[model samples]
Structure formats: C-alpha cells, structure tokens
Target: MGDNVVVSNMELEKLLSMKGGKGEGSYANNSQAQAIHAKSMHHLLKEALDEVQLQDPNIPFVVVDLGCSCGSNTINVVDVIVNHIIKRYEASGLEPPEFSAFFSDLPGNDFNTLFQLLPPSANYGVSMEECLAASNHRAYFAAGVPGSFYRRLFPARFIDVFHSTFSLHWLSQVPECVMDMKSSAYNKGRVCIHGASEITANAYRKQFREDLAGFLRSRSVELKRGGSMFLVCLGRTSVDPTDQGGAGLLFGTHFQDAWDDLVQEGLITSEKRDSFNIPVYAPSLQDVKEVVESDGSFAINKLEVFKGGSPLVVNKPGDDKEVGKALANTCRSVSGVLVEAHIGVKLSEELFLRVERRAASHGKELLEKLQFFHIVASLSFAL
Candidate 1:
C-alpha cells in the first residue's frame, strides 16, 4: 500500500477548477448554497469555545482550522469567535484575551484564495485589524501539509483550539483485501466477481480506528494541556456489515450511481472501476465512539447527527416556491462539475441538462437523505 496519498499541486488545481474558477467563488459566495452542515459546525465550535473560555479566560487561545479549504470558512469561523469574545468581554466587564488563528489544509488548497479574502486593514468593528489590535492578538495561515492527520505539522504544545469541518473521513488508500491476487483481476474490472466481498464493511471500520488513533496521537502532542478540539464529520447510523447501501448513501451515492451508468455507456472503461476506489468513508456512530475512546486523549464534549436540510428552503426562510427555485439552481450548479468530471466536454452541456432534469425529479429525496454529524471534543493533556 502507498505510504501516503498527497494530492499534488496540479491535481489540486484540477479539483478546484471543477468548481469553476479561483477560490470557492460561486460556491462560497452563495450563503444559500453553502452546506447546511457547515453552519451547524460553526454553531458547535462557538459553543465549545465559549465553554473553554469560561473555564480559563487568561489563557491565550490559539485556534487552528484543519482542512480549511480556500480559508473562507476559517475566516467565517474567526469572525464568529471574535464577535463572541467581544460580546462576552462586555458582559463580564473584563479585558479580552489575546487571539490567534492558524488555517491549515492540503498543500493544493488555495492559500492565495484565502489570502485574497483577508482584509488589507481591519475595519473598526469585527475587522481583523481591530480584533487583533484590541486584544493583543495575532493571526497566521499556511499550507503544504498533506498525508494522513496522524503526522505532526506544528510545534509541540502550540495549538489551543483545533477545529476541522467536513473533513477527515477520507481513508489513505483503498482496502488491500479488495485487490485480486491473480493477475490483478480486481484491478481489471472484476471486483464484483472476486475480491469485492473480501474487503467487508468492517474494513472501513478498522481503517477508521487506525486513522483516528493516529490523529489523536498527533494532536495530543501538538495541543496545549487543556486545549479543546472540535471536529464535524459525516457519519452513519448503522453498523450492519451487510449494509452496503448505508456506506454508499453518505459519501457519494449520486457519483457512484453516475459512474455505474457511465460504465454501461462505455464512457468509462470497466478496468478503471476495478482499479480505483473513491476513498470516501463515513463511520457509524458506534465506529466514531470506539475510535475516540481508543485514543484515550480527548473526551467527547458534544456529539450529534445533523440532517442536511434543503439549501433552497434554508435560503428562502419560509417561501416554498422560492425554496424550489433555489434548489433547482443548486442542482444546476453542481451538475456543471459532474458533467465535467464524468461526461466529456463534448457532451458536457447535454449531460448537464440531463442531470439538472434528474435532480429536479429527485431533488427533495437527495435533500432529505443528506445528513452529517458534529463532534466536539476537548483535549486535556500537555503536548
């Protein structure tokens, strides 16, 4: 097995380009289109920070956001935290503690995009400059740390609060048992006939366990003794080994189904299917508990499954008609990416139309099925 799966700069550019041009652009701009799960994550992080701050107000808080794509969400998270701190300071009649933030992600993630989003000069209120100057604070952002989360990337005892959202579920490689021994039959589009079942559902469970252990061990050495960690990840509710549907549903059922269709249509060769796996995994609630407990370094502070409500409905507030329109628009937007990836450019426009129509027909179903989990945990040991 490969020791690490690091996305190269070119690959990262390709992935981001699938969304359109430079730095989250339309996807990030559409407040209505942003994943509902992200907002819930923000809420959970705020609550965690409030709890941590109440326990010790004098300790300078250093917040690090992992897998912080393009740094837009990190900026949003920092904005919320700073605002909360100011409000609390006024309420308690105390000076605000120093604040610092670090944004970390895959080397391919657009740091330039994130930097462009930062204000040149902090504004009077809730501005980066004002917040830092007022609280004797500092902020820094960097990239180029790739591979599994188990590796050390920062100095010891440096981070006070670590936050990651909608990340960390990806496994480093496809299950080894899935590979065929004879002539790589599994890699030759014969997975269904041979090695597919060898790598049972429990394989993912095992991977999660190992990955989480590594993650916790690495974090334990990098976080301050009493610092807190907040992670919001996609998870499953069931643990039945026979439940392939459960595994497929959470990560990319649509993409998988689309891939199957493409194979039948000869757009993608069967050999490709046998050789590559999506590398996405959604651990069950039990799986999550088991992994966290195994680490024995972090304690669960808050954990809950959050459903992905219809983005259209969320954006429209109360208008059902507007909600429908917004949902359609979102489907259209996502289809653009799908067309580019699966269908060739020659058929991109036609495929997009087909996908949009399909989404219109099944949009509500997809919305109802989209759900994730928010896990807020705290670290209690010195690095």
Candidate 2:
C-alpha cells in the first residue's frame, strides 16, 4: 500500500460486476464456455456427494452456488447435484432429502433474470410460492443470495454443500501496490499481472493468497461438519506467475491490446489505460494447495488440473470467425462493465469491438493457442 493506492475494495465491489441481462453481451449468453468446463466436473461432483454425510430427509439438504451469475449454467449445476442426490437415495431405498439451492453473487448481479429462468420442471425448482404450497412433492426451493463469496454469507454450520465455478480467480480487490505509482510493483502499461514484471506479478499473487485464505476461513465457519465443497477455477499450468499460456493470460493480452489501440488512437490517454486493472488472477495448482493446506479446515480429497475439452476448440467448417466472436463476447460479458466504468460507455464499446475484430481476424491461431487450464477439486471438513 502506498500513496498511489487510491482505489478501494468498496469502489471495486461497486464497479466490478459481470454484464447483466440476457442480451448477446450478457454473461448469461456468453457463459457456454463455463458450462463446458463445468460439465467436465460431473464425476467429481458425484464423488463429493458420496463423501458428504447426508442429513435426514426432514432437514432440507442445503446447497449453495457461490458466484452463480445470471445464467442457465447455474441452474444446470444445481440440477446435476439434485439429480445425483435423488438417484443415490432412491437406489438405496431411502427417501430423498428436501432441497434448498441458493444462487449467490455480487449484489449487482441480474438476480431477476436468474429467477425468471428458473423453470417449474421436476429438476428445476419451481417458484418459491408454489414450492411452499407443494412442499412435500416439490424437489427443491430456490433462493438468491447477493454477497461476495470471500466473506461469510451464511450462519455458522448452515450449509451442507458449497459449490463454486469459474469464480475464485477474481480477487476481492486489486493489489494496492500494483496501482501505486510510488511503488516498485506498479504495473505500468499492463492491465494484468500477466507478462508484467516479476514484482508486479508477485503483488498480484500476494493479493490472491490473502483473498483465498479469507474465503476458506469464512466457508469453514459456514459449512457444517461432514459437509463438502466442490470448486472449479481458472488456473495456470506453470508455477511461475508470469506464465502467458493460460486462457486467462490470452484474454488479458487481448484486452490490454484493446486498451493500447485506444491509447494509440488518442481516444483515451495512456494514464487512463494505466489506471485500470482487472481484479483477477490465475493461480497455479501449487498456489491453491498451499492456501488449502494452510487454512487447515478442509481436507483436499481430490485436486487436479485438466485441459478444456473439444467444445472450447472449434473444428467446424468456416466457423473460425464465429469462434473468435464468441471468445470476444465471453471476455466482454465478464469484464465489459468494469471497462465501461473506467473509460465510459462509448470507448468501452469501441475497445471491445476492436477485440472482436482482432479475434475474428486471427481466429484459427487464437483457437489453436487457447489452452484454458481448469482446476477441479473436492474437499470435505477436516474432522
């Protein structure tokens, strides 16, 4: 922290939210990549459930999705969990437990849109009013909780299973030293620690460590004994923080280039570009293991890194341009709001348009180089 550390966590919290609504630029539409990644963890999810000691049928089986942005992917995850639980209980000739699925994210998330998408199907929980009336027959009750996952969001030992996907990479706040011009770690000309100087990368790593520690501490308090947690997050293959091979780094480079284009065109000042940084970090597996081990609340039953599947890489005829556009849209859906906050709506639109163009132009090359590292882990309370 230095004199140049003017940006506060509160300011970042207010500004940093995914693109809301169901438009093309919205996170809901652009989250197919996330769905693809989540599907890869289906077996792990089952394993987590098998390990968790189920509560009596009378006590509702509580499940919470942290950072569950507005999308079908969120619902799909819950659907998978609920279906697995029911199947397991049914096969054993036991009554399935009542379900409560809580979708959580920042307060700015499009919860209304999320609620609207919740169908009355057997798998998808019906409306709260109807669920109450049909309590005995209803599959689950759905609710939305708005808060940061890095802090305590529920009462002590209230949650049975905690789930989060594609969320933990987002730091609670940008490291203060990186934004401080007076500090050696000041990340000039780069919007992320990716490809930045070692000092700058170290600063971001430190912030991630602190944020994750806090997250585990809070979740440990909220999770009941014998509870389980399943998490999937963006990560890097290389232990080095500056490794530029991960999909997150690729996306960061594209965004930084977009900012460079704006700076070069004289539409936005270099200082303006320098002032903005995404509050995200792709940790290595070692980084995550260290945090979990140090927290001492949860035992890591499974921790492995895997590559994204065929869905991420397009092989269709003449679909390179579409692939590029989709990747650009995904990037914008996640980071556009923050960009808009920093550089205004007009330039933000122009900036992402440049991203789309660049991605479309080099679609094949980009797709070939797209190595998205996904870390999936199952953890249970240590005692």
Candidate 3:
C-alpha cells in the first residue's frame, strides 16, 4: 500500500472511539439500513450464484462485502448466501459446497462492534461435526485494510462475489487544492458554484473522475473470472452544465446554507470552511458506466436509478400531528449532532434551536427539491 493508503492502528482506534457519539448521526443507524440493502442485494447475488453453479457443480463460493462498516451488512449477506446455496443444492440434487465470507472496511471501522453482533456457534443449527462434514463453511471479518476500491486490496482472482452499498461514493479524501484554506477561490461552507467559481466546480469534477477510475481498477483485480459484483450508491442526474436546479443543487445548497449559518454565528471560521469538503460525490449514471468500462474487465448487468424520496422527511407511525412531532424529533436528533460537532458544546443548544427555526421556515420547500438516487450496478467478467 502507498503511504496515503495506509491507515495506522492508532487512527483506527480513534475512529472506532468516535463511532458512537452525538456526531455519529445517521452512521449510527447504518445497521438498520444495511439490513434493508442486504434484502435487495440477496436476490441479485443468488441469480449470479446460480449462473456460476451451472458451470461448476462443486465450486467453492466466497463473498466479500467491501466497505462493510461494522460488518453488520456482512452477516446479513452471509445469511442470504448460505440460504441460497442450500436451495441451489436441493434444486440441483447435488451437495452444497463449502463457503467462505470476508468483510472488508477501512482500518478505522469498528470491528469490535461487528464481532459483538455475531452469534456464537450455538446459533448455527448444525452441530460442529455436521457443519464440518456436510459443508466447509467458514466466515471471517477483517478491517483497516484500506479504503481505495480502485486499487487491489486482495490477491488476484481471490474474491468470487463482491458487494457494497452506500459506501463507494466516499472519495479517499477531498482534493488537495481544497485542503488549502489560503486559496482565494475557497468558499468555506458552500459547495455550489454560486459562492464558488467555475474553476472550483471543474476541479471537483476532475477529482471525481480520477476517484471513480481508481475504484473500478481496484475491483478488477480481486474479482475472479466470471465473478459478479454489486454496488448501490448515491447518484446524480446530468443537467445542462449551467442549469443548477436539480438534486445536486438542492443538496449542495442546503449543506452550504447550514454551513453559512454556522459561519455567521461564529461557530466555524471562514478558513475552516475553505479547508473542509464533504467527502461525497454522487455521479450520474453515464459517468458511472464510463468509469466501469474504462477498466475493461467488468460488464454492467443493471444500472437503474431510483429515487427514495426526500431524505429530510421523517415519517413515523402517527396522524399528521404525530407525524410532525416525529419529524421534529428526528430533525432534533440530526441537528443536535451537527451543532455539537461543527459548532461546540457551549453553543450546541442554541445552534440546534436556530436550525429548527430555519427548518420550520423552509424545510417543506426544500424537501420538494431534495432527491436521492439509488443506483444498482451488477458486473461480471472473465479472469
């Protein structure tokens, strides 16, 4: 691994320590979301596995979930694969093959949290003897490997099936130029071209392209010949380069507005804003295909963008009044963390109150414009 790719043990410890705190926010609910994603990915993988079994009856199967935060998703994936293998065996009148699972994530991921969630051998119905004899089943989890999906993390032809959800969009880090707070074009809290110049926008685009290319290249090596990979990540739509009235605009504007408010309140300095960039990039569907094809090893099986509605609206069990209350509660939970982290403990209460007032004034208008895309891409290629 290159120096930039290395994640030290100390850094991993620090990240894990920060895993469950006021600022954790949506990340704390990753387990819940992973379960939902696993359900969707299961069918896709089963189909791929069936295709593979048709070619080789007693082939060993291995599945790897990259960027598997805390390994919650890994367990669910393993459950699905095991069930699928059993069904495949019964249908084909052949014995089930041995299976191995690997969970890969940033060195800083909370592996302890993941391992704690695992059930002991008692949870597996088969006795140790039966498990050993009937199937060569093994499951393993590892962390702190690295974050670059564009680079090879595993040995060549090692992974049989690769899966990731909601994790691929995170760039390794913000572009280096953006890290310099002294740049004249820097707009601390805003990401849109309104506060930023065309140059900044183009710079972001370039960095995104490089990152996307790297992600595809890395996946090419690990996936075995004819192995399948699945990815579901945030995506954006292509607008006229000049037209800024879309999902990207809305998300950028909201985050920028929030940052601007904090800056005006003297919670975060202008210099800090210039130096910080949200480490997320939602590419268009065309952009995604371009990057994947650039690698030349993978063929796209499906690429569909589905909107999951506005991310801001919180719906809970209740009438309109109760729904509003639930929304408020959810917003408070989110804003509270943002305030404490981006602002400070001394101003967290006041900042959260101000944010609530601002949301009350414009939340609905904003939600109408806000959109999230769920892009699922399945790929297969020869070794």
Candidate 4:
C-alpha cells in the first residue's frame, strides 16, 4: 500500500543485488541486448583504452568499469581491454604497465557471484592497495568497489580509463516530488514516468541533471587530464519525454495492466498503484551534453545513439512468444523485486505473465524499441 521507491538509491541497490540480472540467472535471460552491446562496442572501448595508454605510458593503468554486472559479457569486455592495453605497449617495444581494473557497483551487488566469475575475492570492501597485491600484469588485478557512482569513489587524478555500459540511466532515485498527491507531477496509474506527463517528465529530467552533474564532477576529480570515459546507457531519441512508442512505455502499460488485475482482485489499492514510480530515466543526448558542458570537466569527443531494444523485435516480429520472452526478461530483472515487495511475488509473476501474453496477442503494435546515447569524452578540467 506504500511506495516501494520511497527508499534512497543506496537502499534500492541493496535490494537489487539478489535481483540483478546475473550470468545464468533469471535477469540474464533477457540481457542479450547488453551482451551484444558489450561485444559490438569493443572497438570503441579499445580506442579509449588505447588512447589512455598512448597519453600516459609506463605507469600503472588504472581502469574502472563502473556498474560492472556479473557474466561472460563483462569478462569478455574486460579481457578485450586488458589484452589490448598489453598488446599495444608490447607492439610499441615497451613493457606494459600493471593494469588495475576496478569493477564497481552498489554494496549490495553480488560481488561473490561476480568475483567467482573473474578475480578471486580476497576480501570484502577492498581498496586499491589490496587490489594491487593480487594483480599481476599478464593477469592484471581486479577489485570491487561497492557503492554508488553518484558519489566520488576514487582519489583525484588516480584513474586512467573510466567505462560504464547499460548503467547510468538509473537515477539515484525517483524525484521525490513525483509522489506528492497534490503535486500535478504525481504519475498516477503508471509504474514509470516514461514521459506520461509533462510534470512527471520535468521532475525526472531535473533529477537526472543533478545526478549526472554529481557523476561528472566526481569523475572529473578522479581522472587525469585527457583521461577517457566511454558511457553507453539507455537514452531517448528526442528531447520530448512523451514519446510513447518506446519499450519503456509499452511495458509500463502492461505493468499497469498487471496491477489492474490485482486491483480487480482487491489485492492492491489504487492509491498504492498511483504512488509508485521507477527510479530510472532514459535521458536525451541534450540532457547529457547540458550536464557535461555545464560541469566543465570533460570535452565531448563523440556521441551516438544506440538501439535500446533487442534487434529481435524486428527480426522475429511474427514470433510473439520470442519477443515476449525478451521483453518479459528485461522487465523482470529491472522491476521484479519492486513488484514483489509492493504487490506480492505471486502477483508479480502474474503481472509479467499477463504482459507476455498481451505482447503475444498484439504482435503488430508490440514494436516497442528503445535507444541509448553513447557518448565518448576526455577529461578537460576538474572541480
């Protein structure tokens, strides 16, 4: 009967570790988009890493992959980066510096599951010094920093390469104002803002501004001059938030439908339904530029839009079941826990099932593709 998003981003992240889409896990079922994106962007990632090496040579190359979720995709991405840096220097007739790769996420992230997949977990809540002890060049060291990227996590000018993918769209939390019943911004009957209302859109945009500002400011202090940051996260095609054709809107419609079923069954109150909002935003390119330019910490090298949905939406349009599975898994990994907490696990499952079925039935109107703004930057200044 209360809003599940009332908690802070730190708290939400803690609750999500168990629910995070992990390798060989439920959430992983629909992360093909993320996996593909990682490999596809290998060249981009390498270019950034290579640039870092070219600029700063013979020093420990500290690489941080913020929000590094568990699985082979991360491993493959890290492997490419590690091997590239090593080979680049080797080909230039110089010894490769030690590579210290830091995998960061919230404290609640499944570090145990993640470390077992890559580096050994020598200890909990590790630091750079401890991570360095275990790292060897041919093998590089790996450490996990468990906390919000919204805050500064590394020392000033200590980082060389900063990379985040499929992350950053998650704001620290839903803008608190969206919950006020008297506020016109109240996103009634919607599970996410998704540009459903102008007030709601403005509220989300404001939150994104502050969060991105904090992120850029912190990273500016942490990275050296000319340091590179490659970010690939979900973003919108235009400045308008009300574009209703994206997957966020379509799936949210099904989420509402799911809640409607529960309301009919007297399982949840309309007040509760109207009070909730997802703690994330798919920002526009303009939004990112405004934050970065205003911060005066980085110079934009390149920015591009990436398709947000699995290409399968177009390739297998006739196969509703397959399309449904993709969309369902994506929704499940993101909001499964929130739904279970507020609406009950059984109803949560039913909600997604209803969505899957609905997707299956309306194969034609189910073209809910989304996109991301892939922006590349180099540190120009710092706070």
lDDT (10s digit) by residue, model 3, range 245-350:
3335433554456556766877666654444444455666776787777778777777777554444434432233433332333333323332344345555445
Q: What digit string (tens of lDDT, one per residue) describes model 1 on residues 1-383?
A: 12122233234224421132342223344334344557656666677766554325565556777766553666777666666665676688876655656667655455666667776432212544454565434332222343335567788987777777656665544455544335332334432211234344455556657877887888988887656777766555545532433234422344344445556877556544444444446666667777777777777776666553334434433444443344434433333343344335554443333344444565556556543333334444423
- Winner by lDDT between candidate 4 and candidate 3: 4
Flag the better candidate by TM-score, 2 or 4.
2
Off by over 4 Å in 1: 1-35, 41-43, 53-60, 86-94, 122-148, 179-198, 241-247, 250-253, 310-357, 371-383
Scored by Cα lDDT, where does model 3 land?
Answer: 0.54
Q: Write the per-residue lDDT of candidate 2 for residues 37-120, one digit (tens) a residue.
A: 788778888899898776777788889999998888988988888878888778878888778889999887888888888766
Off by over 4 Å in 4: 1-10, 21-25, 53-58, 119-138, 244-247, 308-317, 364-383
Residue 144's lDDT within candidate 1 is 35
Candidate 2: where are CA atoms >4 Å away? Answer: 1-8, 121-138, 310-320
TM-score, cand. 3? 0.73
- Give residue 264's error in model 2 in angstroms: 0.8
CA deviation > 4 Å runs, candidate 3: 1-26, 30-60, 122-147, 181-198, 240-254, 312-357, 360-369
Question: By summed lDDT, which 10 consecutive residues of candidate 3 come out lowest?
Answer: 1-10
Q: Summarize candidate 4's per-residue lDDT along 326-377 as a digit string, tens digits.
A: 5666677666766666656666777788777766665555654334334333
Best by TM-score: 2
